[model samples]
Target chain A: MATLGNSTNIFWHECPVGKLERQRLLKQKGCVVWITGLSGSGKSTLACSLNRELYTRGKLSYVLDGDNLRHGLNKDLGFKAEDRTENIRRVGEVAKLFADAGLICIASLISPYRKDRDACRAMLADENFIEVFMNMPLELCEARDSKGLYKLARAGKIKGFTGIDDPYEPPLNCEIEIQQKDGVCPTPGDMAGEVVSYLEGKGYLHYQ
Target chain B: MATLGNSTNIFWHECPVGKLERQRLLKQKGCVVWITGLSGSGKSTLACSLNRELYTRGKLSYVLDGDNLRHGLNKDLGFKAEDRTENIRRVGEVAKLFADAGLICIASLISPYRKDRDACRAMLADENFIEVFMNMPLELCEARDSKGLYKLARAGKIKGFTGIDDPYEPPLNCEIEIQQKDGVCPTPGDMAGEVVSYLEGKGYLHYQ
Candidate 1:
C-alpha cells in the first residue's frame, strides 16, 4: 500500500484554467469603483444609485456599502482603527473577486487613511480601480448629520471620529469628486449618470 | 444661505428595497447555492458546469469559488477556524447582495462546520438558500486529490483541514446531494441542463 505523503501527489495539482476568457465572454470588464468620503457625503447614495443605473442598463454590478457590510461580512470587526483597516482590507479583497468575475463592483466606505486607501489601490490592476471622492466640506457634513453621528462626535461622545478627533486624507488622484458646497447635493440620478458615463467612455458599459 | 449639514436629509437607511422587484424583472428568483465537500471532491468542477449552463441558457448567474476567492477576497484569512468562519460570513454577505440584485450565486467552499454553514443560510430569505453536499467519500476525494490538499493534511503539513485534521459535519437537510459512488458525476452539459431544468421546474428561472 502507498502512503499519502509523497512528492508525486503535489505534481497532480497543476492545471490551467481560463478565468479571463470567461470574463471576456460576459461582455464587460471587471473593475472596482471605490467611493471614499466623510459621513453624509453621499457615498452610500452614490453607490446605490450607481447600482440601480447599472442594473437598469443591463450591466452586472454590486455595491459594498459600509453599514450593510458591517451587519454581515465585517460583523466581527469593530470601529477601532486597526479593525477599520482590516475591514477595508477584507472588502478590498472581495471587490477584487467581484471584478475578477467580470462585474463592476462599487464600494462605498469612509476609508479615512491615505495609506489604507492607497494600499487598496495598489492591490488592483491599474485600469480596474476608479476612486470617487465624495468631497463635501466638513462643516456641511457635520450639519447634515442624519444619523446624529457628527453631533455625538461634537459632544465628545464618540472617539476617533474621522474629520473630528481623527483625520480623513483625501485621495490625491481620484477619478470623480462629487462636491457638495452650499447645501446642495448632486441628484443621486445625476451622480449615477456620471459614473455610467465614465464607464461608457472607458468602453465598459455596452448593450449586448 | 443654508450650510451643508443643516440641509434637510432624506435617505432610507434600512430598507430591503427592489429585491422582489428585481426578482420579478429577472424572471428568476435569486438565491445562494452553497457547495460544501472535501477538496478535490469536484466542487469547482460542478460549480463551473452549473455556471456555464446558466450562461448558455441566458440566465443571470455567478459563482463564488474557493480557489478564486482565496486568491482574492479571503486571501488574508488562513485555515484557522476563526479565519474560516470569517471567510464564510463574508462570502455569505456578498452572496446576499448578489441575490438581492436577482442573480443566482453558486458559492463553492469546504465550509466544514454545520454551525457556520447554517449561519450562512440564516442570512437570506428562507427559500433563497440552497445547500448542495458534494458527498464524494474521503477516500475517493483523496484518490482524485486534484489539489493534493488531502495529502498535505494527512502529512501534518496543512493544519485545520476539513476531513483529516479537522471535521466536516454533513447537512441535516440539503436541497441537493451529488454522490460519486453508484451515482454518476454529471458532465458539464448534463449538469447545466439539469440545473436549468430544476430552476425552470421550480419557477425560479425565467427568460423575459
Candidate 2:
C-alpha cells in the first residue's frame, strides 16, 4: 500500500557542488546559440566557423547541427510534422542543459516554423538565447544544390522538404541575419569574432 | 499508403565537409568521457574539476552531470528503472552528436546498472568512448550522505535508493578507477593531464 500525505525533507537530497563555480571560473557566461536556415544556406558552415573561433580563444563550446543530429540523436524520429516538433523539442531541452552548465551551445537546424523557434526561446532566458538566421534565397540554395536535395524535392521525390514541398517561416526578428545571397560569409574567424563580441557586449566574458 | 525504403543515397547524405578537419583547427579531438559512480561518490566534483582543467588548457570540452540534466532534458523522467534507461539512452544519443561534431563530451552519472552503461558504450566506437569509475565504498558514501539519500534509505523513508534499497552493478571493465577509499583524489591538473595524454596517445592532437 502507498502512504498518503507523507512528507520528505528536501535537505536530505545530495546537492551537486561546483557547477556554478565552474561557470564563474570560465569568466564568460554559457548559453545556446541557435542558427536556423534553409538547407545549404550556410548554417553548418557558420556553426563550424563559430565553433572553431571559440575554440581558438579557449572558450568551451559545441555545435549541434541538423544533419549530424538527425544521423544520430533523432535518427529514429521521422520527417513527419509531429516528429519535427518532437525533434526540435528534444534539442531545446538538451540545449537548455548545455546552457545551464555554462557551455556555449551552437545548434543549426532548418527549423522552419516560428512557433518552434519561439518555443526554444521560451526555454531559456532572454540573455542566454541567441538566434542567428542564415537567410539565402531558395533559388540560390537550389543552385548550390549541395546535397541535391532541392532537385529531389522538385522531382516530387522528397516530400515535405523545406523551401519546396514544405514551408520555412523566416524569423521576423533575429539577433543577426547573415545573408549569403550576396555571396559573402564572414569567414569562420569573423563569424566567431562576431559571436564572441555579442557575448562580450552581454557581459558574458569576464575571464578574458 | 506509405512508400518507405532505404534512403536512396544514404552514404551521400554525409556532411559535405569533414568534421575532423574542423576539430583539428579547433585544437581538440572529439571524444566522450563517461564517468559512473554511486551517489555521493564525487562524480560531480571530479567532472567539474576536469572541466576546469580543460578550460584552462584551452581545450573544447563540456560536462553533463546528473542533477543538472534532470533539471532540464530529463525533467519529466522519474527514477524508475525504465525511466533511468530512457534517461541514459537520451544522454548517449546527445553525447554521440557532440562527439561527432568534434567536441570532448564529459558525462558523469551514477549510471548504476551495467546494462545501461553498456548501452552507452555500444553507442560509440571503441576509440571515442572512455569510462571512468568512482569506487567509493557504500558505507563511505552513506557516511558522507551528501544527498541525505542514504539516511532516507536507512530510515525506510526512500524506496529504491541506489546502493541501499536498490542495486548498483559494478563496471566489469573501466578505463580508469579513482580509488578514493582513503579520501585522496588526483589533482584536477593530473586528471586533465591524463585526458590530454590519452588524446595524444590516440593521435588526436597534432595541429599547431
lDDT score of residue A88 within candidate 1 = 90
Q: Residue by residue across A98-207, what tens digits does model 2's lDDT show? A: 67656778888889999998999899997688998887888878888877778888999888899998899999988877764356655655666777788778766554
Scoring the B chain of model 1 against the true B chain gives a TM-score of 0.86
The residue ranges of model 1 lying beyond 4 angstroms of the native Cα positions read: A1-27, A180-185, B1-17, B24-27, B181-188
C-alpha TM-score for every candidate? 0.85, 0.72
Against the true structure, whose lDDT is highest? 1
How far residue A143's Cα lies from its native spot in candidate 1, in Å, is 1.8
lDDT of 1 by residue, A80-131 (tens): 7888898898888877767766778888889999888888888898778999
Please report, in order, the local distance difference test score of every candidate based on alpha carbons: 0.75, 0.73
DockQ each: 0.22, 0.18
Q: What is candidate 1's lDDT per residue for B95-180, written digit by digit as tens?
A: 88778767788888888899998998999976789888888888888988767777777888777677887888988898877775
Docking class of 2: incorrect
- Cα-based lDDT at residue B138, candidate 1: 84
Number of backbone collisions per candidate: 3, 3
